[model samples]
Target: MTATLIFLLLFLLGLFLALRPLLGPKEPFPEPPRREELLEELEVLKREVEALEGEEKKLALARMVELERALEGYRPPEPRPFNPLPVALVLGAVVLLGVGLWRYTLPRLPGETTVTARAEARELKALSDKAKKTGAVEDLLAWGRKAFELGVYEQAAEAYMEVLKKDPRNVEAVRRVGILLFLSGRPEEARLFLEIAQHAEPMAAEGWLFLGNLYFQEGRYQEAIAAWERYLEMGGEARERVQGLIAMARAQAQGGKDGKSVYQARCAACHGARGEGGVGPRLQGNPILKAKEAVREIVLQGRGTMPAVPLAPEELSALLDYLDSL
Candidate 1:
């Protein structure tokens, strides 16, 4: 409603500016220099002609005659006929254009009649109605998930909160609320909630992913690496982006090049910064380092969700040395 009012005011203001010059000023059209005044001047000239004699008098009489002839020839200019049709037509067109843009050109807000949006709204309505009648956890969850997908955050929150009230241990509700908190910019609070969700359901890969994001934002590189590793360990699908994130975090953690830095940069994200088990198995006490050739093969030809990570020969040697030390 506020947006509509603002658009309308702007349109009206533009119309006023456009019409102002053509409508002219409010003061009365300056009286057209008065025909009576011209006649009075002619009379004065005639009197002067009578008072004078000879050539001057003849010249004055000629000037008076000229003024009289001018007066005789003068006609008041015709007033412009005011036809309202053109103005009405222009105004009508503006209104039609405005209406057309509002109805069609501009994007409609969600839940306001696009086919997909309407279908989703109907589904949500049915879910909401079912939730209200049954007060069932499943119905509430369905409502919350559907609402969230439609970008109806408030409704999603409401449904999730209801679920939480009924079942405080509901990991789905807890995880989604944590995500909502993260999106709403309360990262500290988001961390607490996401931690709770993670502990509640360790296999929820999305919780671990977001937890990693939160830790990364706080510059906790090791924890971020751990969380993302856990996400991958649990079979999260966004492997490539997470691998990049892990690489960047490791570089930040190890500020210069060396065996340790190379290991951190190349392998820490999946295998853990300290090599405690993560997406990749624990290497801290593993026998894998004894088989360097096999490790090199795996590094060159990625297996499963892991992509091949190319490294310079020197860097690879340093990383292997670092792993042996671990």
Candidate 2:
């Protein structure tokens, strides 16, 4: 409303300026020639009367009266000055139109639009910076979560990282960062942080499950199985499905020829070829039969201290086949 008033005032001012020249005083037109002609006739009659005798004087007087009556019947045109109001109004309207055009049309130009957009962007940036500096941890976290929800991974990661730094033991922050890292192709780093969080708070089933998935990604089938089993032991509820996975792995391990060979090439790298523990858990015994579901789940997922390995389905199948045979 205020903006509208200002625009109206400006338009009025422009109109007034345009019309001012027309408002000044104007000169009146000259009187008609009839008046001057009548005056000259009267002077001629006076001279004739002066020259006439008594009878001639009476006749002259009668002629003068007739002339006066004729003169009275002959009306002179009234003198008039030109009115400037109409011209002033036209000029004022033109000025108003020009001002209206300028105000409404100028901002639509590409350059002006670009400038306006840039200014808006700068203002937003300033507000964001201010919020980051002054807002509370919870507020920042909420904002970060909102960004994450919007699929702005980089912004979400930054927010989660800050939260982690501020409160290393924050389970939610740790989990969020881990997920972000995993999605960003940093599964190894994600696994590390997730494991730390799980160890810090073992009761968190989601953390354990996520850890198990990471171990599985790393090809530590036995470890993956172990983590999942632990999650279950801690009251995780996916028992039937987990058991089914365990049965499949055992059958494959028993049937495949490369079981021992694959184990030597891959499994030995961590757990040693002979089923003895090295960088990872021991593989010997019916640990598969004993901890079958647990082992499969752990290998399929991942656990603390292990990074996720990008294994193809066939490779995972073969590796599981080998672990089962062992």
Candidate 3:
């Protein structure tokens, strides 16, 4: 009931507000003039219009006279002299573009003079032959076994290098060079060639073997073994040889007598008969032997050109005994 009363009040208030503006008081109107007074007013208005018309005629005459004078006396100045600045700016911009082309763009264009493939190859052959004739046997051997496999590593390296000089993309030459490098104790250089060879021929056992041998020379035996094993796994024909080497290395590590004998035969060539130091360090008093286990480790592990010798368990014990006696 209260809610109904409130709504009724709001509606009545809105209606009243809307009607107020229209219902408000209006202003009073002015009284009309008499006919005689209106006629007098008209006469005054007519005189004022006549005076305005006379003034307008005078203004029009004065304006016409001024226009006639201006026409007789006025002359336009000659066209302003031409300026060179616009032309100079355009020429400067063109010159700058030409200079830029000469310095940067032109050199890189397709027809720019460059060494031809044949010329490059000839130069490479010349250099390789020069290197070969210089009696760089080690260098040749280090660079050339993969392509020729001719056993004359020095000659092969020269020939391969010549081929590479001419055509660096020659896969066979690259592989041969890498192998030669590996054999020549230049493993670091060989790595690049081997990697390229491997990429070119992934299944090539020779490349893997060379890479493995390179790893071995670098004292990365585990890597070397892995490479060799990979080669073997791929059905390389030298599987037995690799296995024998691995076995020999294992046997040597175990301190076998056979390992000692192998060491004496092979290592003695440089290291001396009595382990008293020759081209290599003296093994007898080697601080490494102070630790019984260390002696065995060195023998089995081998280092730098020393092949891992395969020795029986008993042979290893005898080898250790012999080393101790030394």
Best by lDDT: 1
TM-score of each: 0.51, 0.35, 0.32
For model 1, what is the error of residue 192's alpha carbon versus the real structure, in angstroms, after optimal superposition?
2.5
Residue 293 accuracy (lDDT) in model 1: 95
Tell me model 3's lDDT, rounded to 2 decimals: 0.62
Model 1, C-alpha of 30: deviation from truth (Å)? 4.1
lDDT (tens digit, per residue) of candidate 1 on 1-326: 45556667767765775576597776676554568888888878866776798998888888887788878888988887887876776677678658744654245446354445445666778888999889999999999998888788888888998999999999999998898888788999899889999997544898999999999888777789999999999989999999999998887756533567767767889989898868988889799779999888778787787789887787778678888888
Most TM-score-accurate candidate: 1
Tens digit of per-residue lDDT, candidate 2, span 1-326: 34446667776776776666657556487544476677687789888788888988998888888778767777855655767776667677767766665554433322233445445444434544654886656755775676566556776788778777777778777877887787788888999878777777535665667676677666556566677777777776777766565554444433433446455655578887677778987776645536655755666677787554445566666667667666
Off by over 4 Å in 3: 1-147, 248-326
Model 1 poorest 10 in a row by lDDT = 104-113
lDDT of 3 by residue, 204-256 (tens): 88777788777766655556677778778777788888887666544443343
RMSD, model 2, all Cα superposed?
18.7
TM-score of 2: 0.35
RMSD of 3: 28.2
Backbone clashes counted, model 2 = 26
Worst 10 residues of 3 by lDDT: 105-114
Preferred candidate (TM-score higher): 1 or 2: 1
